[model samples]
Target: MHDEIARLARHVAPRRATRVASAGELAQPVLVVGSTLPVGQLEVIFRRPEVGSVAVQDDAAPTRTGIVTRAGLAAALTGRLGYGRAVLERRPTGAVADWSPLVVEQGTALADVAALAMARTAERRYDDVLVSGPAAWGAASTADVMRAVVAELAERSTHDPLTLLPGRSATWYALRHRCSLVRGGATRVVLVLLDVRDMSRLNAEHGQDAGDAVLAELAARIGAALPAGCEVGRVEGDGFAVLATLPAMDDIQAAASADALRQHVLAHLAAPSDGFDPAAWPALHSAAAWSVAGAADADELVAQAERRLRRERRAAVLV
Candidate 1:
């Protein structure tokens, strides 16, 4: 059983919440100035604490723009006095601006922003992401962009790759959520664990493709067999689970429901489909359990169900 269930069950919001679907959500209003702004004047503007970054519009090409951070401006002006403060400070801001800025549309997703930001050369990798919008230009700092990336990755970690199902962390979280619902709601939640006994043997006898196809096919079949208010996720490579709420049932009724569902799943898998061959398949076992009005936490219920699935009554050992 996964030890991280308790940790995952707590819903900890990301620094930048997972809801940040686009770069626009991370944007901060920035100062926009004409390209012709004097370098010395730009430096003076940086002195004002309100200005985090400045967007410079190209005078020759109005639609084209560049960005300058206070640090970037300092880097430009701190050079040994070549032309003197008098001559050099007056050069157009564009000369010192990052002409190749990481510009993104306001609607661009944070994942895309992170990709563009990281793909940049090391010098520009930490540059702010410029948001080009209809009304105004905004900036998303590289740090914030990275935070958004972190949140995005965290959200993804809870999901399975091939089945696109909520993975281990997410499964535990949902289990808790459903347990709460069942306590006050008009139903009871049951967890069903199905193990494919021949997974490793299938892979060795056929190939990885066949093994994968079987898991995917079983997931689909189990999902289709379940009632309207149920969810199925891939917890282990060869194991799939279903969390379903049925009309209040006694322990006897619950076990019967579980058996009926299990048999339906096995019957479906016994036949060959586009995903696998019947000849390559072998014994399958399943165990089902539920809490009485949320008496058990998700981890305990899952551990209980997994323990039952270990012997032949459920299926051959996971190998």
Candidate 2:
């Protein structure tokens, strides 16, 4: 007895793992068994409460396997079949399993699984989606899949159409989300607004296609050249916003960081990749204005930045 106790303590026993995969994030262990089990026995098996569904391997039509849900089994025996347990009690459990349950491979995308689940007939529309693996089976709830799909759609909506950068709504949302965290330090928020010199005239002089290429190229320059952690967004036509949260502790450091970022963006605009010829595109130039704020005053910060940009444009005209 002592030897058995010591050996058991030394070697940890294995336990069933609850695993989550890309196919469905919320995964649950599903009991998989052969078809010969009595239908009435499932009532006792399901009483433990952890098992949401069961995969019964059998020679059922439409698919070789089926999922028997607790609710499904109950309804099948007591409601669907006329004689209730009297008729189904002696039958194999496979006879009552959902033969047309949606089956997906282990790595299938959540959105696709959700779509497939909803596409099923009304009778089986909310059935558990079975994740088939090389050696095991798993299941996911239809509600979880739908929630994932909704989140994916919400995020996709925030992308700008042309540059594919975060659009105005996303930019505002990020600023608001991070506002509280950046309480008061040196000016921690850097908002740079850039617009082409003469967007309308440029399009007229060249073509709409050239204007688009310029915006896309400009977005690439800022998105690629900025230091990591900075968020770049194309908030409006011919205008881009770069929101940066700096670690500067003083005005001097904040000023230095902002100027450095401005220079970095301008330098990248002048320079192109080795394979690309700059002469192929129009001499891409933009007017830029910057605003730095230490508080969570996004509105005031943006207004000051726009005012500065206007003054700079007027100065350029005078020159």
Candidate with maximal TM-score: 2
TM-score, structure 1 vs. true? 0.54
For model 1, residues 1-319, the per-residue Cα lDDT tens digits are 1121111112222122345778888898888998998888888899998787899999999988999987787767776664444565989888888877999998998888888899999988898889988999999898888887787677678767677667876777778877776665435567888877767788899898877777776677776765545677888878888776555656666566655655555666666676356687656778877676535467777987888887555334333
| Alpha-carbon local distance difference test for all models | 0.74, 0.68
Clashes of each: 1, 0
- Stretches of candidate 2 off by over 4 Å are 1-57, 60-65, 69-93, 103-123, 130-140, 176-180, 183-187, 200-214, 273-277, 280-296, 312-319
Give the range of the ten consecutive residues with the poorest summed lDDT in model 2. Answer: 4-13
